[model samples]
Target chain A: MTERGLLIVLSGPSGVGKGTVRKAIFESEGTDFEYSISMTTRNMREGEVEGVDYFFRTREEFEELIAAGQMLEYAEYAGNYYGTPLTYVNDTLDQGKDVFLEIEVQGAMKVKEKVADGVFIFLTPPDLTELKSRIVGRGTDELSVIEERMEIAKAEIDMMSHYDYAVVNDKVELAVDRIKEIINSEHLRVARVIHRYIKMIKEL
Target chain B: MTERGLLIVLSGPSGVGKGTVRKAIFESEGTDFEYSISMTTRNMREGEVEGVDYFFRTREEFEELIAAGQMLEYAEYAGNYYGTPLTYVNDTLDQGKDVFLEIEVQGAMKVKEKVADGVFIFLTPPDLTELKSRIVGRGTDELSVIEERMEIAKAEIDMMSHYDYAVVNDKVELAVDRIKEIINSEHLRVARVIHRYIKMIKEL
Candidate 1:
């Protein structure tokens, strides 16, 4: 019997190297995972593919999906619609491929309410000092903006209690290795194996 | 700060290759784990090293340890006492080393009650048919004994629900790989990180 794929929710505060760790995982084992393409009302960039990068939709269409209860989690940020579409995730899982959802903490909590069985992983910085330096090093935000992000990060780190696992992003490669181990071990959970045993016992 | 070592309880029914899988893992990663040495009142066989194979002890000595609350689990069969020594396990863990306890289902459950935080893993044969064949293949027991073992296997398989993880021993390498992943990922659990965060936040 084919086992259903795992749904992994990876979330972290800003500047925590979630992107770098995820990228390393994909580069290391590309075919084993499928990235969940989100739906958005924002304009697509030049290199972004239609279905691969995101499913671009109008505000009205996105709202209809929300009304129809098709979006797993959605949020309006700066007047732009961004949400996860449930069908694509379900389809990929039904095909026996693991789905990776990289979302923010708030959206992660929302997804947890719907998919209680999904593995929720919180990626964190090594320490507050390192987190501050990373934010300062990015050079994309002003000092005030960086301070605001640090505040948000503190709040998000408090939510680590809600997650099943926490990986400190000390090194991107090491963090990716830890996440891969987590995925491997979760597949061996007893709840996932009992069904197969039931069938075997019946046959016996 | 030094993280506490993990205590893993690995149990399975007869003919499930638990020993083979464990031996493979130890051979693969010799320095990463410590095997819990058991204490037994039975006579030591030739070539059996004391403290390594078993801490050969008299019935009086074993009973004294049991009365002292030093034995994690103990049972008497054929007028011989057999049990796991708690001090060895705790001392090894105190030094920040993973401890592997290979015991029966009942013993594993006993350890679980004593150490509520240990990881429990149930290993099983690929199928009932395979399990039956393996028992018969051993040629150490009669037909009636084999039948009784099959009945016991059914009961133990039902107890998988009480375990945290289950691995099918279809291939020794694969089962060892799964167990190794479980150990690695368990270190990344959220609860383990929350304490560290609390200290860091306080210093900040």
Candidate 2:
């Protein structure tokens, strides 16, 4: 029987190379996941275009979806709007396609609440100090800002229990390979609940 | 840091080829696992020496271990004493070797009760008719015995929810290979409860 695509929810610390790992997963062997395009009100950067980096939308459209309960989850950060569209994810999954969502810790939790059987993947930085380095390397934020990000990371890591699998993103390529492996492994799992409805071939 | 092994308990219906996969796991890619040698009071079969198939022991000796709480879990099946030795399993696990325990459902449950962190794998036949065919192929007894066995098999398959993982034994080699993959995949699972104590390294 052809296996259904896994609904994988992946999240990581601020700079654990999740994007790199995500790219590698698409390039890996036997991986059947498709990225779910998220609708956002944030304007595109210099070279970014609609339907590329994001499904860029206006504030009215985003709010209309939110008002209509079309948004799976959404939040405003630094005066920017971002949200996942319920229709896009549902359509992909119903067609037996695995869907990937690049979301924050809060968004991850929200997605899980919306999808009961969602598989949560928590990506970790190789080492805590390395994570701090990556955070600070983003062009010398105040030490206080770096420390605040570290604190947020600690809180995010603590939510690891809410996740089904955790990947250490020391090397982006390897982490992506592991993520792809996780999707493959999940397909082999038996139904958590099944009835004994036997179709008797011999009796027929 | 080197990862620790997962304690997996494998159980299933009699004709589901658990033994076949068990053997394949050892013969194929189980170099990391400490295949648990169970202790039994039953007489050894021809060429089945002590500590290989089982740790042949006297009934009194078995009772002594049970009394002293050395046995992880024990059962009296068809007038034979079968049990897992706790000390041997713990010692081997401390050395970072994965452990595979081929046990019955009841004993698997008991072991889970003892070790809350244990992972359970339940194997199932491809179909009910296939199970009956395999049981009849054994040429053990009459129609009544075969019927009784089928009834038990049905009950066992229905109990798959109690297990953490399940794989259909459609092909012995395939099932065995999948089991190996599950073990390997589990080893890469960094968020298991026992593994939480690992201090996430902080490095650039």
TM-score of each: 0.90, 0.85
Q: Where is the poorest 10-residue window by lDDT in model 2 chain A?
A: A195-204
Question: In model 2, what lDDT does residue B18 have?
Answer: 76
lDDT of 2 by residue, B148-185 (tens): 77776766766676777777888888888667767766
What are the per-model C-alpha RMSD values against the true structure?
2.6, 3.6
- Cα lDDT for residue B136, candidate 2: 86
Residue-level lDDT of model 2, residues A97-176, one tens digit each, is 88998777877888988887877888887667677788888885788988887777777777777888888787777787
Please give the range of 10 consecutive residues that has the lowest summed lDDT in model 1 chain A: A22-31
lDDT of 1 at A117: 82
lDDT per residue as tens, model 1, A1-204: 467899998999877987567768778862388888778898987788787667899999999999999988987753688789899888988888899987778778999998888899999988889987887887777888878777778888888889999998888888888899898888889887688877766666
| Top TM-score prediction, candidate number | 1
TM-score of 1: 0.90
